[model samples]
Target: MNIDDILAAAESEAPDTRTVKVCVNPAVARKRAALLEALKQAKELDAKASTTEERLGAAPAPTTEHADRAQAELEAFDDEVLKSLITLKFTRLDGERWSNLTAANPMRVDVALDRNYGYNFDAVSKTAAMLTGVRLSDDGEELLTPEQWDRLFKRLSGHDFRLIIDAVWTLNEYAPSQHIEALVKGFGAA
Candidate 1:
């Protein structure tokens, strides 16, 4: 072999630095570019949203007037609720009165307790037919109409809520030691 041939055989080949291979269809090239642009925009939007969320996380301080008004209203409602709880009376002993109260106006309990704490309507209705309906006994002597029962039950629920609030308020606002002593004496808590 000639000297030139020997030199050529010893030389390293250059790397291929080319980016394009076979040319893509124009439509395909356009779609790929559009997709890349959309991806860039989506990333930018995500960044903006994160910044906005950070800004929204910190709340402004409340005004004293508004705060005082809300507290006063809540306290007044609690006082009234405590009174209602003290006064509510449930009388179910008189047969004629119970009949009058329950049987006069028929009431059907449509909405029922959700599954979180109690059974749904389908399960409860199967056990107690009267839970889903209010009807008269064969002998018609009534105590309260269905409407009356509804109002009475609503007031009873209000009383329950108020009493709970009053209990909490008494413990927190009154003498803690006295409240604890009363609770210990009354409820026999260990």
Candidate 2:
């Protein structure tokens, strides 16, 4: 290919992006967790009931009713939780910017190499750089400023906050081969 063709291809490449949904309401989060636990326990009870029926040839009616009730509650609450979630979109930084950012914020860790000296990532700065001024809309019409992002981050639960940061880091740092591996695994390919 000509140099012009190579330059055009490079310039046309779109930035990688990822979106994460975070539950902002503590009450909704608690309710969702409780519903999920109830559903899990109900499923377990149903399985036990099935095993008992195979042995004794009689399954209790109450077990089926309980499981059905728990499932219905969870399904109904799932819709509500979906409506309450705050969606954040992260875009990958350019290679040079990403390298500079990582260099500026390094964390020390134990390595397998000599002297156990390993430098890793600094979570705080890296997350800040990745999540700052994130888009809030698909059309890129709305965005959260750095200050707004910080406030939102602080408001999130520990689990929710970690999920957002992890998604951002993954979008920016995960290799293309890793993405293909994930896609293959998701499709249950050997």
Most accurate candidate by TM-score: 2
lDDT, candidate 2, equals: 0.68
lDDT of 1 by residue, 1-190 (tens): 9998886874554311111111113334444455556555655665566566667884443224433444454555454343332221121122243334334433444543333313232222211221222323335433455565455434444334334333322322234457568989898784
Kindly list the per-residue Cα lDDT of model 2 for residues 1-190, writing each as its tens digit. 9999998998898777777778777788889899989988988888787778777867544357668999899888887887668777677776676666666655454534212312244353345444543645547636676677667767788888777767766765665548778999999994
Q: TM-score for candidate 1, please give it.
A: 0.23
Candidate lDDT values, in order: 0.38, 0.68
